[model samples]
Every structure is written in structure tokens, then in C-alpha cells.
Target: MVPRNRSVRRTKAALQSALVDLLLEQKNLQSVTVQAICDRANISRSTFYLHFENKDEVLSSYLLQMIGRVHDALRAWTGSDDTRWTVYFAHIAHIAPILGSLSLDGGPHAILSRYERQFAVIMQDLVMPGRVPTNDTAVGYAAHYLSGGLLALTWWWVEEDRCGTPAQEMSRRYHALCSGQLCP
Candidate 1:
């Protein structure tokens, strides 16, 4: 459950901020330790424990906030449907540094899966809808497949620098690649 009250919220924010700063310096997630985080934030280890169970919880919580912002942008889309990929790429790129750090193998795939499922449901609502296959099995498989592809592409884009191009250029190419699907 989300913390209630101003002090709890501030403590949570401080923990999150300290976590991010540590990540920036470490260049990896597994190196982070709860005691270190508590020390960095000037909070008691008990205080950190009060807010998060472990480092994984901290990373998941941080990534979810980034994912939530992108999801909100996707839901609020009002531009040409053709611009959807551009919007998505821009949103993901904007949040890449923080979120990407949390994508290490040490992190739980279940957390990533949960967020991807949410994104898939949103995509189904926006992009598939009545067009979803009549068979529930088929629709489930389709959503799962599509969500995995998106997750893989996004992961590769942020982690591998696969495009070897600027984000704006990659966004352009992404839109171009999906033009056929976006239109019809």
C-alpha cells in the first residue's frame, strides 16, 4: 500500500532519491544495499525497513513510477494515431536512465511482467479492441506475444543502444516502421 501522510511520503521520496543517486554512481543495481541506502538518506535502517522490504522493492517501486508516467502519456494521447510510436519512444527515452538501471537480471521478472501486462492491456484497449480474436486463448496469446515483443524491443533499445542513432532519429524510424500498422 502507498504510504499515507506528508512525513511518510517525504521519507519514501528520500529513499527513492537516495536509491537513484546510488544507482547513478554504481552503474549497476545489484551493488545497492539497504543499509547503504538508509545511511545515504540519513534515515535509520528501521525507517527504510518501514517503507520497503528490500532493494528489489525499491527498484520495482521506482520503475513503476516511470512506467506509470509513460502509461499516462499513452492513455492521454490526442495526436494523430500515426504519431503513437513517436509518442511512446519519446516517453520511454525520457525515462530510460532510471528505469533501465532497474532492468538487471537480479531484478524480479514478475515485477517487469506485471508492468508489461498493464501496458499490454492498455494496448489491447487502444489498438486491438473488438479486433481481438474471438477465442479467449488466442487473445491472451496475442497480448502476451505482443507485450513480450514490445518489452524486448524497449529493453534492447535502452540497454543495447541497438539503433546507434539519436533518440529523435530512432523515434522517426520507429514511426516509419509502424506506419503500415498504424494506418491499416
Candidate 2:
């Protein structure tokens, strides 16, 4: 195993924090530049380049950290199949603050596609242990359908002012689907 470097880690964190603070005021990621980030973080250009390739990499790294936390929470639920979905959603709830706060460049559709693919991998692992299904067509179909449904629900929850009805409806629909019952 390689040795850990504390100073490098601290510089990376400084850059990330600066980026987040800048985004909060800038509102659009495109408005920020690498020089601005380096300036705010009080690091040399070479230092920034050493840690990250560019702005996108820096932002992606920050987002991935948040995703990693959720991933850990998901992995921790290594229990019965009955509680898999429950634990998954519970983890989502735990990370709702960070997830909701994320403002990415791509539109919601693009983001959800990535989200679904990632979750599909996680779901397959949780459902099948060492044997992840390799049936491409089936996996694609399931990922598309499930991602679309989840994305639609997530969109409404994020965009619409009303939350109670949409959440209740989703809960009912999800329960019905999981219980071998389909809803129109």
C-alpha cells in the first residue's frame, strides 16, 4: 500500500471549499475560472494542477465525495433483501441536504441518467452479492425504466412547491410495485 500524504490532502480540501464558496455566489459554474479558484484557495497554479486536472475535475471530485458517503451508507445495509429498498431510501433521506444542494452543469435529465446507472449497479450488487447479472439488454431496460420513474418523482419533488402529495403518491406507487402490484 502507498503511504498517505496529509499536506496534499489539505490543499485539495482547501481548493474544494473555495470552489463551493465561489459557486454559491456565482450561481453558474461556467462563470468561475481556474485562476479564480487558485486565487481564492491561496494555492499556486502548479499546486492546483497537481491535485486536479481542471474545474470539472475539482467539482466532480467534490460531488463524488458526497456520493461516496451515500455509497458507504448503502453498503452498510448488508442485510436481508426485504430491507434493501428501505435502507436505500433511508440513506437518500440522510443525504438529502447535499443532494438537493448540488447544482450541476447538465440538465436534470442528464444528471438522472447518471444517477440511475450508478444506482442500478449498486442495486444489482445488493440484490445479487457476488453474481452481478451480465444480461446487457435486461439491465439496460431495467435501468432505463427505473431511472425514468425515479427521476420523474425526484424532479417533481425538487421543482414543485408541493411535496406531501407527490411523496405520498410515490410511496404508494413504490410499495405497490415492490409488492407485485402495478398501478396506473
Candidate 3:
């Protein structure tokens, strides 16, 4: 059973790596095929189907792993001394190519939705600790708005060549906006 679990993990890792490589090489993710991924991973078609329903599933899985890392970073953050935001932005910059492919594929609505839900829960737990909003609707709206705005900003940052804008600067601007500052 342990060997089987290990094999599954290895296969999934190979598939994830292949997908990332393929995404980096291709302009459009829609054009990538299961067969191509299998070939790149040196796995058979049957093996791919055993783990993933399709290429989109593989992409979704990969994104969930990335989001999990971000969540872990957020959880580790402590007070004003934390540089989690900068670290998050640096991670995003590192994965910009993979994100660019997802953006090219009409953007990742599912992944964004997942992030929105996670962010909402995190906000409720951290930002509003020991207090519950009387109006759940308002809280929901605010959460959605903040999450969407953050996602949009991240998308813009990844798409544009900001001429060597450091992750720390970008994160500072994000914090400024979050703090209701109109001008960064």
C-alpha cells in the first residue's frame, strides 16, 4: 500500500511538472492535449486517466497546491513584522508564466473562486476575530470585492512589464489600497 501511494505521488508530480513545462512553452493552454502531457511525463494515457480526469483537472490540482502554499504563508504571518505579503508576491512573480497561460485560457475562474472562498474564511477568522458581522451579506460582499480586486491587481502585475518593480513595492501598494489610501 505504501509503494502504491508513493507511485501515485510520483506520477502526479511528473504530470504536474509536465504541465508546467508545457504551459511555459505554449501560448494557449487550450491547445495542450492529454497525449502531449503523457508524452512529456513519459507516462501512458491510461496512467494519466488513473490520476486525473483531464488536463484541466491537472491544472486545477496544480493551482490548489500553489494556493495551499500561499495559505500556509498567510498562517505563518505574525503582526506587522511579517513579510508574508512580499513573499507571496515573489512567489506569484516566480509562477507568472504558469499564471500567464491560465490567463490566456480565459483566466482561471474556478481557481479564483476557490481563492475567494479561502480568503473570505481567512478574513473572517483573522481580521474579524471575536466579532461577527451582523450583516452577513455585507461581509460576503466585502470579501468578494477584496478578493476580486486583489486578483485583478495580481493579473495586471503579471501581464505588464513594470520595469523592475520589486515584489516589496508591489505588496506595499496593495497594502496601501487595502488601507483605503487612494494614491500609493
Which one is best on lDDT?
3
Model 2: which residue pairs collide?
Answer: none
Taking all chains together, each candidate's TM-score versus the true structure is: 0.76, 0.64, 0.85
RMSD of each: 4.2, 4.5, 2.7
The weakest ten consecutive residues by lDDT in model 3 span 79-88
Ordering by TM-score: 3, 1, 2
Give the Cα lDDT of each candidate: 0.70, 0.63, 0.77
After superposition, which runs of candidate 2 have C-alpha atoms over 4 Å from their true positions?
Answer: 1-4, 78-108, 111-116, 130-148, 161-184
Per-residue lDDT over 1-184 for candidate 1, one digit per residue giving the tens place of the 0 to 100 score = 4546888889888888889888877766778888888988999999998989997787778777776776677667777565555666776676666556666644434556768777667667656778856457777666676667667667778777553445555555545544433311
lDDT of 2 by residue, 1-184 (tens): 2235778778888999888777776765777889999999999999999999998678777766765665676578665544444543554454343334453444445555566766666545444445535566666566556555655655555445234343335555654665578887
Steric overlap count per candidate = 0, 0, 0
Weakest lDDT window of 10 consecutive positions for candidate 2: 159-168
- Return the lDDT, model 1, position 148: 72
Give the winner by lDDT: 1 or 3: 3
User: Model 1 shows how many backbone clashes?
Assistant: 0
TM-score of 3: 0.85
Error of 2 at 67 (Å): 1.6
Give the local distance difference test score of model 2.
Answer: 0.63
Residue 66 of model 3 has an lDDT of 85
